[model samples]
Target chain A: MATKSVKTAQRYAMVIDAKKCINCKACVVACKAENQVPLGVFRNWIDEETSGEYPHLRMSFDPEQCHHCADPSCVRVCPTGASWQREDGIVLVNEDDCIGCKYCIIACPYDARYHNPETHTVGKCTFCSHRVDRGELPACVETCPSKVRVFGDLNDPKSQLHQLLATRRYEVKNPQTGNGPQLYYLL
Target chain B: MREPVWEFLIVNYLFLGGLSAGLYFASALATWIQEDGRSAYPRIARWGALLAPWPVSLGSALLVLDLGKPMRFWKIFFHFRWRSPMSIGSWLLVAFTFLSLAYLWSWLEQDERQSLQARIPGKIRKRIPARVQRWLDLDASLWRRNLAMLGFPIAVGVGIYTGVLLGAVQARPFWNTNLVAQMFLFSALSSGTAALVVARLMDREPVELKEMRFLYSMDITLIVLELFIVLPYLIHGELSSLAVKEALAQVLGGPFTIVFWLFFMGIGLLLPLAIELYEFKPVILGKGTFHIQPRWALTAGGLVLFGGYMLRYIFVFAGQATGFR
Candidate 1:
């Protein structure tokens, strides 16, 4: 949709193809190792959904994390303004201002946020902004065994993410939330 | 099987916040009525004013304690965001507490000749300097009226904010209805009135029969009103999308069904409502003389308080039990 006449910041997005996922959970482990997420809580996870019965059964391993929506419910519900969004649409929590009331945990439709017992603040997936800032991929995107995840700027017409959106049929989780979530699941 | 972000502390805070709002509203009503030359319910104004602050103070403390970083609770006060219910609620609570305290002070500052002065210790009364005593004894009728008028909407806001705090969470379908706020407001009013009735009847002072009857009738109306709003709240949830329907099933026929039907609906609401209707029926029908029986009044009032708490408990836990999944 871009004419390339106006400059805009990179709008980061993720597209996952669950059909290729083997559910080895390497991405989950890598996310934890990179983010140091507290034990018993996760910044990213793999959920398994099975369908049919008997010999016709099929299962899908869906890896999930914060969508970092265009309009995030967690940001709207935060009382202290600790939860905020970047110009590039990456939602992050400022630990210094978070009182840890946990309202955002309840507000998240995807159950993405967790109370990090170690840091005593709400923690969630940030798309590994630290790595992205350094011209590197997120730990999860880099670690997936089957190449299940594609991460790039949706605003860049030349990027693989933009190309996928232009050519593929995909669905987003909980579209009813009206948060305009950026995570796309290729159908 | 995700953990709930809130627990018992939040339930208590919701209940107490609503109760304090209801109490303050009821007291403001009493203050306005007393201005009409009715002398029976002066004690209601005093009792409600005095008791309103305690529950809210304790509730706010519990809310802060429930936080992950309790010491950083003060950060909520640095700025206010109108779009955030928690931010609005925090400011509402602080404003209500101060108004409640000021409202209490107005009652206490009434002319020293009143019976309230007799309760003060003789030594403490004597120790006060003449100038301070004169100032303390000034007739604060105007201040009382103005404060009551100003505080009425604030109290209502506090009552509604408790429900809106949960209702604002779109992710939790169980609490995503506007009816929750309306139901909570009426429930708060009923519980506040019940509290005043219980305190007045249990005290050593002689209960004003007229005031007692007024409170009974009011509670009955409020209880019935609460029932109307609560049913709609349930029906609205059940009739929404599948996620909302499933979330509401937690109370409809799910694990919370027992407490929802038995404690809150039966004992908490219907039973107390039946008692008040029975007690007030005689007075309304004009068939025979009736007296305010302390025993029955206490029973009804206590049940209402219990029911109010149960409403918050069920909604809090059940709402958290389900989400967009």
Candidate 2:
């Protein structure tokens, strides 16, 4: 029942440039490679939205991942604490303890979680916890061609993500969900 | 928005929970009123109590099998997070099954006291250890009392928890209503009572009509209750999101129209109600054998059970037909 909030750690966050993303799906490919994500399941994905019929057609490619919300529903709904949070704000799934009940999958409002067919457990973007612990960037950030992705410690004032969040006009997805999503999109 | 994470097994599990819960509750009620010495309906109490625990244990087994890592399902017991309904349900189900078994054993053993124990030789009965007699005495003393104290709430919990399991999902708006728990409980009771009636009819040796005014009227009331909770939950459903509206439409007149209207509403709910209503106050014919028909009563009970299952099936499947998009 105790929380890990007592630890002094950097909270990681991501900011993506929607205008720069070409829907190339390079981030998706990189994520799968790094995580060994199964087919028909995704830790992160791109959602394409368009409106208007003819001349005024507007379109955007929205690259989405787990928000690692301040109040994560997946963590709360997980019966065995399989879905949990680190002090640094990254949400992680402990595959060993997961019962594959899909409670977390239903709880996630953003559809960020996926049931891993191979592991027989629910999984989501871990914010590349392995690489983060090794002082390396996530595979999506490392592999992005146009430098459209920025991932860093939000608590570190010097990090690009911190400066971008302060300087640029950005918005989080599904603000109405009230999870306080950490991932931001630069408008 | 995607393939449903819960499938038919989950539906079956829900049905079993409701059915078992209803039977236990009905058995308890039958025992409570049997003091008035109603011979026609005492069989319901006896068979219902005897049959309650098996389906519950079987349903729990299905739930474990549904979890792909069936071995890992043990984690649910070791890890009990209060916020998670599934976590609480794991333990609740175990408690329910154990207590229901005790209840069944105690009630069935009472019948043995007269028949089996009386046949035991006085010398042998005397030679039996005091400890053995005490254990046998528990059915009448401890378990029968425990059935009243613990059995009722545990049964209700099993009935409502199925609804809570799905209703807890905030992403699935169609099932997220507070009314879901009430609706499921009512359906469980209606179906459960029908199961009791069917079981009672099965034991009857006489082909002639029997006086079961209590069972028929009780079933009719329960059928009315099923409609009472279900109608508003279906009709004035709150459209919290566009996805919910799409999901609710499936039940109204969409992809699941025939199942919802024809099978569930018409045959399951309405027809059962109508048949039972006719049998509740049938017109007396020549010899009066044509008047109070046991077959009509049997049909009504069976139909109510069918409706109960269809209700669970539609709620789970249609709830997913439109999901978070």
Candidate 3:
């Protein structure tokens, strides 16, 4: 049962080629529009790393959202089971079930979720399951001019995402939290 | 300026009031059980029963008042969704209010003079219906007992829900943690105890020294736990940790420090602990009950209540201000 479950698990992941990212924030805008995210709260965000004080300053931007972890901390602490890791490894919120208690918000080490002021409930990225179900890429990935975000099923051996992940070394955000985020950043 | 702020404030007030009411009810229960002769347990219990519902109702009202569309508040009940904390809290508040009202009515109707007169068999020439009298007596007592029994957990549950609500948000580093709800629960207990103590002192009722001592010890323990839970997160070098540290520093050293140290720690915990400890020593040594002046108890209670409010305000504002920067 365990082997079959593992074998059949449709793990979806995103590989971001940081070198190719131009920091245009197209992904952020696209995600906001697609999700109808409220003002002052975001499902996606950019983290900037800076180096040098003066003469030679350089900057790098890392766009982040829910990493849809294999062992999601948000799921673990949720008292109502509103936040759950789907069979396909997608960390999703059943908005209808969510109590707007915001436990998952605090448990998330990455600060990926937000409480919608209008709805009085929690909201976050769901890896664009709606689009994925319709046989399309996530809005952010589709809108990205640089094609920096590579999304696909990790379980499929023939998938480009699977082949790339197998070949390249990548890092997940806040690995210490033990969430095992599916989103990987190429060094 | 923002709608979320109003929502946050409403939630804050509800939690605070619920906590205060819970502590009051608990102390009242202690009075009911202990039945000490000199102690003002009955009065306190009566007051607590009467007082518990108003704050929550008012807080709920405040929530509606702050709503952009006030009339829509009823929609929460009609369109109840288990997924919404507001929805759950709303229904809980309604149930709690009804329970509280029943409890209050029972307490108010138990007129000692009337009961004493009735106890005298054939004292009243006018015949009273046995069934009506029995029903009145039994129903009142039953409701009072039931409400008192159920009140404790419900109050605590509602109070703790506030912290859980905020803590559940993974997006805000300051508000996130399982400890958040526990912290909120402690705050509620502390605040509720303080409010009742203050009210009791105001009424010149012989305050429960033992109860005060217990509350003081609990308050100090909770504050210490809160500090312990926050210390590691603040000092950790991660980005979120650093942000939390910055916010903590602002609280510890900035404008909020006076309230945090002077009111919350010094007056709220330290002064009360010192006095209670002094009393404990004498009491334990068979030197008679430590007589705490009503004035001192009231002062301490007021400070503790202030401290509780400050704690919540500091945490909520600081958490929001520090996140993302």
What residue pairs are clashing in model 1? none
Worst 10 residues of 1 chain B by lDDT: B109-118
User: What's the distance in Å from true for residue B55, model 2?
Assistant: 1.3
DockQ for candidate 2: 0.64
Clashing pairs in 2: none
Interface RMSD of each: 0.8, 1.4, 7.5
lDDT of 3 by residue, B1-325 (tens): 1122423555457455655456545554644464444334566666677677777777667666655345545655665546545556667777777777667666766575367546767856247678756755554644555567777777777777667666655545566655677767766776676677677666655656665655555555555665565455445523445545555665567666776677666766567655545644555577776676766666666766666676677666655544433
Candidate 3 Cα outliers beyond 4 Å, as residue runs:
A1-9, A29-43, A71-108, A114-123, B1-11, B14-18, B35-40, B59-99, B110-139, B142-183, B204-259, B271-293, B320-325
Comparing 1 and 2 on lDDT, the stronger one: 1
lDDT of 2 by residue, B1-325 (tens): 6777888988999999889888888877766664444424456676778888988888999999888688998898898899998998888899989888777777765666557677889999999899987776555533464475678888899888988888887767788878898888888877888887787778745433442555666777877877887777766674446656666888777778899898899999999899877665553222333355668778888888898899889888887656556
**DockQ ranking, best first:** 1, 2, 3
Ranking by lDDT: 1, 2, 3
Candidate number that wins on TM-score, 1 or 2: 1
User: A99-187, model 1: which lDDT tens digit per residue?
Assistant: 99999999999999999989889999999999999999999999998999999999999999899989999999999988899999999
Q: Write the per-residue lDDT of candidate 1 for residues B16-92, one digit (tens) a residue.
A: 99999989888888877764565347888888888988899999999999999999999999968778999999999
DockQ, per model, reads 0.81, 0.64, 0.10
Best by TM-score: 1
